[model samples]
Target: MDELITVRFFGMVAEKLGKQELVLENPGNSDRLLEHLNENYPDLKEIKFSLAVNKKLCTEPSIIPIGAEVAILPPFSGG
Candidate 1:
């Protein structure tokens, strides 16, 4: 098995995921990671959010090393 990475979700995604953080086997890179997530949580495909790898916003999937910190930020909505 590959190393494990942690993905954090904020706002709506977090609510849907039902947690703030998740530990998953590093799926090679960020793109694969998203695929894993989408497979695990098919609902994510329709959600609008910014993905970050190691605290940096990323549109492309990045390689997730062991213990990497990834985050998902949902579109912000305010009054």
Candidate 2:
């Protein structure tokens, strides 16, 4: 069995995914996860978003442990 990772999608990303969260198998690192997602959901490639692992924003690719908490945050506009 593959390792399952819990991933949360916020704002537009969630809407695009049609679910607030997803369980992925062996997502590997942040970059690998992006690649897996992009391969599965090509639309994600065009949507600008930030990735977070274990509640911490990740600007660069990093390892994602099994069952780790991940989230994808879309661009925000605020006053």
Candidate 3:
């Protein structure tokens, strides 16, 4: 069965995706999710950001759990 993950984007990520959040269907794998994202938004390949699952930063995209909340955080700037 396919699972749906909620992806939340922040800062530039949100701007690039044109939405604050997105619902994606996956098979409970981070790599698969990345593939979906890369396939859907080829432009995202040029941008750098971090993918967090359930508020925790993850290095391997396959760490995301099914039906978990994913957050995309871009580089932050402060003065």
Candidate 4:
């Protein structure tokens, strides 16, 4: 059986994609996931975002285990 990844989009990212969440075939790593997203959603390339794996922010490409939950977040601001 193939592994799956759950992706959650936030803020403008969700608005652009028109959905808040998606389930995709696991790409194995963050880099591959980004590539897939860019190919499938070209508009995402024009937007800046961050990735969090299993609720933890990732600064670099990281391995994605089976059934991982990934969150795409737009830039945040503070008052």
Candidate 5:
């Protein structure tokens, strides 16, 4: 059996990808996952976004546990 990662896109990120969620093979870490996504979805590189692993914000390269839920979040604005 192969491990999988669940990715959820929010706001503009989802608009760019044309979907809100996806399941993919585990990419080992956050950096690898972002690389893979950028390679496959060039539009992603056009906008700034953040990564959250298992609902926690990941500011740097972090291990992605198998079956983890990752979210691609667009910049947020609050007043």
Candidate 6:
């Protein structure tokens, strides 16, 4: 069975992906998720972004449970 993961994009990342939210299947971890995103959304590879899982910011290769909400946040710019 495939797992469902929710991905939310912010700022330029969202713009690049052309959406604020997306649903991905069988995302085992941040690593797999990144690979899937980069494959489907090639532009994602060119940008700098942070990964958040279940509202907590996480480094790559982190575990991603089923139904987890993953966020792609663009680099922050200070005013």
All candidates' lDDT scores?
Answer: 0.84, 0.86, 0.80, 0.94, 0.94, 0.87
Candidate 2 lDDT over residue span 1-79, tens digit each:
3488988988888888798988878668998889888998787887899999999999888999887989999997876
Any idea how many clashes model 4 has?
Answer: 0
Q: Candidate 3: lDDT of 2?
A: 33
**For candidate 6, what is the TM-score?**
0.89
Name the TM-score of candidate 1: 0.87
Using lDDT as the measure, what is the rank order of every candidate, best first?
Answer: 5, 4, 6, 2, 1, 3
Instruction: Give the alpha carbon lDDT tens digit for every residue of 18-72 in model 1.
Output: 9899988777787787778899998898899888888888867577777788899
Residue 32 lDDT in candidate 1: 81
Weakest lDDT window of 10 consecutive positions for candidate 3: 24-33
Candidate 5 weakest lDDT stretch, 10 residues? 1-10
Instruction: Please report the TM-score between candidate 4 and the true structure.
Output: 0.92
Q: In candidate 5, which residue ranges exceed 4 Å CA deviation?
A: none
> Against the true structure, what is each candidate's TM-score?
0.87, 0.88, 0.84, 0.92, 0.92, 0.89
lDDT of 4 by residue, 1-79 (tens): 3498899999889999999999999999999999999999998998999999999999998999899999999986766
Off by over 4 Å in 3: none
Q: Each candidate: how many clashes?
A: 1, 0, 2, 0, 0, 0
- Winner by TM-score: 5
What's model 5's TM-score?
0.92
Misplaced by over 4 Å in model 6 are none
Q: Record all residue pairs in model 4 with backbone atoms less than 3 Å apart, i.e. clashing.
A: none
Per-candidate RMSD vs. true structure?
A: 1.9, 1.9, 2.0, 1.7, 1.6, 1.9
